[model samples]
Target: MSQKRNIFEEVGEQKASTPTPQGGMIDQGRGGARRGIRAWLMVLFAMVVVMVVVGGLTRLTDSGLSITEWRPVTGAIPPLSEADWQAEFDKYKQIDQWAIDNQWMELADFKEIYWWEWGHRQIGRVIGLVWALGFFGFLLARQIPTGWTGRLLFIGGLGGLQGAVGWWMVASGVTSGEGVTTVASYRLATHLGLAFLILGYIAWFIMLLSRPERDLMQARRQKEAKLWGLSTGLLHLAGVQILLGALVAGIDAGRSFTDWPLMMGQFFPPEAFSISPLWKNFFENPGLVQFIHRMVGYLLFAFAIVVFLRGRKSAHGATRAAFAAAFIALSAQVVLGIYTVVTAAPWNVAIVHQVFAILVFTLILRARFLSGYPIVTSIRGA
Candidate 1:
């Protein structure tokens, strides 16, 4: 039998046993290999960025329609022999681009363009392989964080859809009767818009995974509601501008004017709606499309400035810095956009503009994210 201590006895005479310490549920399991998963995502992110640049190059080279078919699996193996190369070139000749534009291209020229398209598709395939491996590896290992299974699956689903849409975009140009040399502008816009959407989702997930769950939870309590709203609006506007930029790229609209602050030396482009139907002009008319893109870009920059000013007022030093970075990117992008226009969208300048657009987009997202989950600073601003 155990002896009980008298209430009046000296408390220090008896040693007390303490219970083992345990972390709260929020901190339990440490959110399932966040660093490992983030590393995987970073790999995927770099691949996607490469894919975008290669895609822009393919379009600029007019090589997108060179393949003429979407053999997702079989296409991975490019032509291995002279006969196979001829067969591929023969297939390309059936398209309007070959008939109307690239008839001057011999077998060697065909191979040159062929490689650009092939490399673009190969990059895409590699990206898919990487995503599948990382995602399923994490899955079978059961290392996926809570509430993340669906998010990962969503990205995979979008990848599959993007592949299908890519074929759809190519098919639009594969036809012979309509004299369609390039893919449909709207379809190109749709394909590119989906790409950006997927990129945006990946970026957001990376940001979320960067911090621990408990820290994120605690930071969420200090979310700046107004700043979040403004940034959200800015993000949407940026999306629209990106789509418009895609439309501009789709039809070589950027090369049409080659002027700044004016289109053909006028505030408005003449023959803006020259197409037979009113709606076709919006998609097919280079002047009008470029004008719309320019107008939206101006509006987006103005809105970004407004958001930046508000972001400067944030109490958190990190949040303010994030916004400043975004604003600076915006300013650079605007200058790049102007240069892209004045230079008539040369392949080099245009590709830089496109890649820089991604940078601007990512910086804005970073600012927006910090606004929602700000990093806390010490009194001395550590």
Candidate 2:
């Protein structure tokens, strides 16, 4: 009261000392090396993509059965001497693939297929090592963001399970008396399906890590729930189509009917259900499997159209653009599917189609992510 002054004095003239309130945990530790974790995930994503392509080529070349055993650790060391090569070839000869299909394969010819399977396995080992080193390294350094440990560990666990499932797929063909020249079609589908699942997880995590947790939390508040739901449905539909495509590849079904708009000049192939027990035809019959795959492809494209239309209504420009890109990818994928079929599923064309499928998948995932956590932009759309 004794220090009263003029009432019209400027407000800035007073300076009261007050403590600045520190933010919560996220602002304290720089969010635990998010950029570093994201960089590591990007590397893993590329490796998984390569692994899928190589695995496809391995299947396309009929080289998956070259290695009869799954010596996860020991198998990393390929044959160094001629004797070791012969030993591997000897194992290959015991399988029905040798007795029924490749009866004329010489030791030299055997080595060709051996290298494909070996390379595929070697890539897997490298992926595991990279994941282990990056994960444990960050873990020891305490650089992993909160709530990410379980997510990282889940990917590693899936990688391990994929290895086991891969062996299960190969074991189906390593028989002496079943006249089985290829792995079981369902098992092949399972293996390919798991690969895509791992890819999806890696991609999701990378996107999450690209931004700070605070931003993600804030963006999530404005999520387009309906669009996200639609995209989620589209994702599930695409997953089924992927599995069906795997079945088609597993039995070489795409090569059986090399026509467009119709299979063998008709709406359906003549011997669609020739396989016995009726149920076996869906998985074992080439004609039926390809027909199913084609039908599903059409359905997926139609659904994609619906999702695309819905995405166009989004308020966020970035979200709309993401969906547009995804739609274009899906369209290209459909064309690629037709081309692959018309060309009899040659390895070269088939691999392109497979890789494009991955592209479409990733784009769709991006669109879905944007729907959930849209990027805020200025009025000028910057």
Give the alpha-carbon lDDT of every model.
Answer: 0.92, 0.93
lDDT of 1 by residue, 105-197 (tens): 999999999999999999889989999999999999999998898998898899889889999998999988689899998999998889888
Clash tally, candidates in order: 0, 0
Q: How close is candidate 2 to the true structure, as a TM-score?
A: 0.94
Residue 374, candidate 1: Cα error in Å is 0.9
Which 10-residue span in candidate 2 carries the lowest summed lDDT?
11-20
Q: Could you estimate the TM-score for every candidate?
A: 0.95, 0.94
Q: Which stretches of candidate 1 lie over 4 Å from their true place?
A: 1-19
lDDT of 1: 0.92
